[model samples]
Target: MTTITTRTVEYPADGLTMIGHLALPAGVDRRPAVLLGPEGMGLSDVERRRADALAELGYIALAFDLHGGRYLGDPEEMLARCLPLLADPDRMRGIGHAALDVLRTEPRTDPDRIAAVGYGTGGAVGLELGRGGVSLRAIGTVNATTTGRPGEAAHIRCPVWAGVGSEDPIMPPEQRNAFTAEMQAAGVDWRLTVYGGALHAFHHPPVGHPVVPGVGYHPRHAQRAWRDVVDLLAECLPVTEDLGA
Candidate 1:
């Protein structure tokens, strides 16, 4: 049977309760852990499923909430809620650090082998964490757009893997190119994958929506992106004896 734990953690700074879904591999003393930042919609069932999926791969996954318990399927509403947080880099970094601390403090989590993964605006948050001098083993982002300010990438000390859809209108090709260039100039280890014909939120195949005209989900790319995420996590996280057996 799969072993998983779910709990809600409160942020003292904001007095907001953030739901956390934790999954641990059975019989492990300390396992590598991942800090999962939810998309603009906050901690939804989709994010919970992703955490469960990660547990199946022998890693302790912690999915965090950015907007408390509020979630909306509308893109405009999500943007309105997340834009303010995104505008203030310091506040965004604080949230990431807070979540990281919670994940690292878990009894079953290995502090040294911690990584972060995020989607959409949460991806930008994860990137900022790396740029804010967070000692992460690796970072993965899906359909992220906002690159950091000048010299921001210089502080990142870990490898970053960004997955984007070529056909995504929200994140244009020029922006992605510029972001990659900044990463290269900053001497940060990074990888970018552009999936042709894929749309925004490609990894969220279960969330059916027609947010943008002529843009929908792509199952093939979604599956591929998920596999890529698992592979990246396995590469960055330390191997445990339980998983080795």
Candidate 2:
């Protein structure tokens, strides 16, 4: 097994002190990196582990925070915080930029070689960063087919991959269509994958008491989505051995 190291990071955003998790592979030089975004609830162990896994795969990773380092176990609280943030593109971009800056400032990160992968609200943040003209190598999002302001998507320069459950009521066909239309209008290289028989938040494991309606865990599809994200990274932002030399 490859040696990986991790640490907690703190930064400011949205009038809150955001706490992030950074993961690094054992190496001596700069390497490809990924900006990982967590679900609307906030930064949790799941995202931290994902960051570690990416580091083990030979990439530096930062799992950024939302909600001021607090995990919103109540659906109402999560929606209350995320809904407004999602509605404002500038705010979302600010959050993403703050996290990206942390990653870029890390000595082990290759500034020119980076990707963004996010889940739920975090995914929306990834899309916003792309729309804000960040030079990401790739963008991957799950359950985040939210569309941004008109004409904003044209700024995206990297390929995008998005996945959602077919039965996701929150991201119904209309939402998906709108998101795809924006991508097409922007001439972005984009792909969407809808996993059958899955629900919203299907990639997430069961957590907290009284799970939200219309959200359920699908272990099989969750694994499949992870694999898809990994494949996207491999194809668009491969880390060569020379990067660590």
Top candidate when judged by lDDT against the true structure: 2
**Each prediction's RMSD to truth:** 2.1, 1.3
Taking the tens digit of each residue's C-alpha lDDT, what string does model 1 give over 8-77?
5655323466656666666647888888888776778888888888877777888887876667678688
Model 2 lDDT tens row, 78-122: 889899999999999999999999999999899999999999999
- Model 1 global lDDT (CA atoms, 0 to 1): 0.80
Q: In candidate 2, which residue pairs get closer than 3 Å at backbone N, Cα or C atoms, i.e. clash?
A: none
Error of 1 at 172 (Å): 0.8
Best candidate, TM-score-wise?
Answer: 2
